[model samples]
Target: QGRGRRRRRVAPLAVSPPPASERGEEPLLRGIFEIGKRSCDVVLSARRLRWSPIVPESPAGGTGREEIIEMKDVFSVKLKRRRFVGQKKGGTLLGITIFKCLHKEENKLTDCAVHLNNLSEDHCNSWFRHLKEILNGFQNRPKSLKVFVNPSSHKREATHVYYEKVAPLFKLADIKTDIIRIFIDFVFCVGGDGSVSEVAHGLLLKAQIDAGKGTDYIPAPVRASVPLGVIPAGEAKQYCYILSVICFKSLWHIL
Candidate 1:
């Protein structure tokens, strides 16, 4: 071994490991880009809401079926309500017995049959007077009266109950009304506060548009102008607080 110059073995160069984030740099960069894009999208959506002009669709007068289809996709979801009409025939044992007795009396006192031989004349006269008054009230109702019904107000069949049970009472009172769906005009809503707010907004927009068109001479429907009669069908009836006209019993009377 020539010991001219002992060259020490060169140590292998130490390689430094990549940083943790650097190892996953591609995914990290993609996530950041996606977040930025979403933020931009949200900002643009907000701007669109502010700048966009809302226009009412032309009234479709042919049949309501087509209009219902057109509006189906516009709202979030259909809210439903349960309603009962005049008491059912066989709901309870007591109800059944009472109905049976009334039915028996009516059958016996038919036009073809003889009047109750035992009852006094004064009793019959008083009953007939009361019946006449009720009939007169129903016969002389306001022609301008119109009823807006929201069948889907509550989770139950409230609309059905109203149509069957409650509506007849109005008719008996001589009020001429058509049980129209609230959606026909945007001025009616089914839920609570949000629903009423939407109706108010629609009315405001309609008023603005009508004014712009110089057709202010024509009056919008009364439902649009007056305070909406709320049925309080949903979880919250907050709008009722604002209007100061929330009444569970009067909902029947409003119709």
Candidate 2:
């Protein structure tokens, strides 16, 4: 050949939608906000996210067939980049470095050996920049948040672990709370399917009481029919498997 031409190969851009496992049975964007003592994770669907608080009982009265109850409609909001950054730091850092930075950046940075040792100076600086962005964004976000907890499901120590390990991250995310009382948008049980049933029952009772007074006691859009989230804390979390509850083990992968 007298003349030859070479072709350049172009790399394809890869764009991925949120995993079905995280998005659940429906395709919707979810926003997770930390509300002080509690964390609220909201999921929005195209129409509305419906939750049934009660299931009708069987005629025999031995067991009741669960009936779906409609909860509320919500507009999906994508999880902010900062929230994701906070999650990443929570997994890596020991405590709320960002908040500590707000008050005493120098002291906090010096004390956090675990985080410092693991992360390089460049990484740490980048994280702080990301945290600043997140803090700026939180100013315009909603103040209230929903909380879900499974008191009876996890081992006795699990709660302590959550307090020590997880709670600080929420603080870092700039989640605020009342002085004495904590207002949770929604509280959920973290156990087997039975635990979910128990939570649903409790929520239904609360809803009935609120309805009697003609006041919305639970303000979160998902009040009585709050969305359920779970982490495998018990010996056998069979329900978690069915519902596709995100587990701690899988968190690293998803986030």
Candidate 3:
């Protein structure tokens, strides 16, 4: 067997893509930046820039959407967006401004900007690193969300409301919130508290946790306190009463 042993054949070396550091790839930047009293999560990636408002704690839905800046159409970063400077009060001022003109409608001009009022010096390095990485080329990290739609809740046309209200925002943010047993980010509960409570129980894996326990009732899991939201449908007890009185104003602003 030793005398008949065949010589080892070497495999040809194949080229691989360059390392992120070597390729001069940019790191994606994400953090809060403010405009007046409102604050938003600003994301800077190689291909695009976007900012989404920080939603407040409320059962009331937020209208905050991540607005994207198309790189192909972006001719220039206005002076305010070119360089982030220091503030007299304290901290760094990182700003992002965009002017959009649609391809189909070239004459249209829309301008908007958001500034980081006072980012702490301690956190500046990371932000600057992200900005540098974005300048080079940064890979996008997709977001995971849990979207719940209650079609049978309010009117017969409630599903239409969900498409009009929630889906577009998710699309803009490039988040996929497909149904799954477990969820990563916020759980948008569109119905009442009872269903939300049950969903929380399942998300916490209570059935497995409570298995083999002698107790008839499984106590609520401590980690079941996921961030949940319940929007009032006219069919529900609350918003129906409130909205009916408010003359049923269009809900476009809330979501």
RMSD of each: 31.8, 27.8, 22.2
TM-score of 3: 0.29
Runs in model 2 with CA error above 4 Å? Answer: 1-179, 213-225, 245-255
Q: 1 or 2, which is superior by lDDT?
A: 2
The TM-score values for the models, in the order shown, are 0.22, 0.21, 0.29
| Deviation from native of the Cα of residue 111 in model 1, angstroms | 29
Q: Give the lDDT of residue 56 in candidate 3.
A: 81
- Which residue runs of candidate 1 sit more than 4 Å off their true CA positions? 1-123, 130-144, 156-158, 171-174, 184-255
CA lDDT, every model vs. true structure:
0.37, 0.40, 0.50
Per-residue accuracy of model 2 over 1-255 as CA lDDT, tens digit each: 646867778889888887865453462433322223223333334323222212225354232222221111111111222335436533433221212212246454211111112123443444345434433444455554554544432323445655676566455444553322233444545666667557666666655554453344645423453344555556676767765634443453434
lDDT of 3 by residue, 1-255 (tens): 689889999999999987875442243666676756678767666666666777887466453876776554443232132333653343334453333335545665443333454345445555555544443342344466775654433333456776886566455434677742323344544554455455555656643343423334656434433344445432444533443332233233234
Alpha-carbon error at 192 in model 2, in Å? 2.8
What's the residue-level lDDT of 206 in candidate 2? 53
> Where does candidate 3 clash, by residue pair?
26-133, 27-133
Model 3: residues >4 Å from true position, as ranges? 1-27, 58-63, 75-104, 107-112, 121-255
Clashes per candidate (backbone, < 3 Å): 13, 7, 2
**Higher TM-score: candidate 1 or 2?**
1
- Count clashing pairs, candidate 1: 13
Model 1, 1-255: lDDT tens digits are 677988889999999987764442221110000121121111111001001112225263121111101111111111112235875442321100000011238444211111111123443344334323333334333544667775544433568878877665444434567667763322235677777677676666554553453334545532233344555566776676656454443364455
